[model samples]
Target: MSDYVTYDESDHVVTLTLNAPEKRNAISTFADCDAVVEAVRRVNRDRGVRAVILTGAGTAFCAGGDLKAMRDRKGIIEGSHADLRENYRRGVQAMANALYECDAPTIAAVNGPAIGLGLDVACMCDIRIASEKARFAESFIKVGIVPGDGGAWLLPRVVGMSMACELSFTGDQIDAATAKEIRLVSRVVPHDELLPAARALAARIAANPPEMVRMTKRLLREGQHMRLSSLLEISAAYQALAHSTEDHKEAVSAMLEKREPRFTGR
Candidate 1:
């Protein structure tokens, strides 16, 4: 994994921290994207990891792409037009896809600014919790570009098309309160409480059977794009598989015995 991202695991929850605070944790190069992708893949491979919290190392969560790199045509931004397109596919786009496809449910703990690609990355998570100091903006337009990191698809799904259009068109930054009002974040907490809140949430999710949580997340993702009937069929299959697990039997027995379930993730 690249040094730009740090991975920590505890109590079945994995925390992925963007480590570069000097540039406000901006994803500056293809290596940065690879770091994020590898972290997500690592979590997916570990069945014991029931939840993931994504946050940054210092004040800012992520300030989006490195502006200096963009201006100087350096890092991922350095290339011909065709080369740039390919770069995106291998870099930011790959990171986005990895997060979206991650088996463990992801919670983006937005500690500060989430601008342009940063906002898109937050949207890629299954849930977002923001700090009071957090700010969000669909700011690619301000940089004379569109949402090349899948913001166009993600923002609309998270905040509705009209709100996405307004944010994308204006490129105006919204404080945590406004972000919560528009459903960009599920909730907002004090700056110091951000990580704690995220961990608490992740812990709640991790308390359940790990396999069930993964299947449930998969079902939710599929439901977003599948027909209701098709989703029901898939759900039925998942339910049948779930019923066959040792954890499922333990859960049912615990309910009858009036005790907490001891799930083995079977």
Candidate 2:
């Protein structure tokens, strides 16, 4: 964790908050990207961390890249054309990959605007719960650029190809209700309830067997790019591993005893 991203954990859930409120929590530099990636890596390294919630401080979940930085060619965008390409590859793209490959289940608490890279990052999560104040846009086109952080691949998978195309092509903003209608976000709550809702969801996920949850998330990620037959084989292997965990036996015993299960993430 650093100045850009704040990390907090409790009850097997880690929350990473984008902290640059004055710039609307925009990721302005390579260091900002590193902070996010590090936070995710921290979550993955902790076996007790069963879930993650990504949100932002103040308002605006994230306003994407800083406009001033882009205009001035400072920070992440500072360099020649070739340098810019490398910057993106090592900067935002790295952050995106880290989040996408995170072992624990991730939930985005979209408290406000999630534009361009912000929207894309939210999509990287397994679940997104938005505040009524939340707004979203795949607006890279507005800046005469493309999604250098994998939005093209991530967006379509979340909202379908046609809607993704429309959003990217037009650079238009959609409110929380519209996002929910298009299946972009799973739930929308009042602004004050956003964090609570996300935390509740994370708690529910964390209450389950931790290893099984991580394996299930891995299987889901693999299924995205794998053939069904291949996925079945991998799932079978995971099922074998799952059945061997003490948590699994505890779950079975708890069920048979007709009592609430207490998972130690064993």
Q: What are the per-model C-alpha RMSD values against the true structure?
A: 0.8, 0.9
Stretches > 4 Å off in candidate 2: none
Q: Per-residue lDDT of 1-266 in model 2, one digit per residue for the tens?
A: 35899999998899999999998999889899999999988888899999999999988999999999988989989888899999998999999999999999999999999999999999999999999999999999999999999999999999999999999999999999999999999989998999999999999999899999999999989998999999999999999998888999999999999999988877
Off by over 4 Å in 1: none
Report lDDT per candidate.
Answer: 0.94, 0.93
What TM-scores do the predictions have? 0.98, 0.98
Expressed as tens digits, the lDDT of each residue in 130-165 for candidate 1 is: 999999999999989989999999999999999999
The lDDT of model 1 is 0.94
Q: Residue 160: error of model 1 in Å?
A: 0.6
Q: Candidate 2 — worst ten consecutive residues by lDDT sum?
A: 1-10
How many clashes (backbone N, Cα, C below 3 Å) per candidate? 0, 0
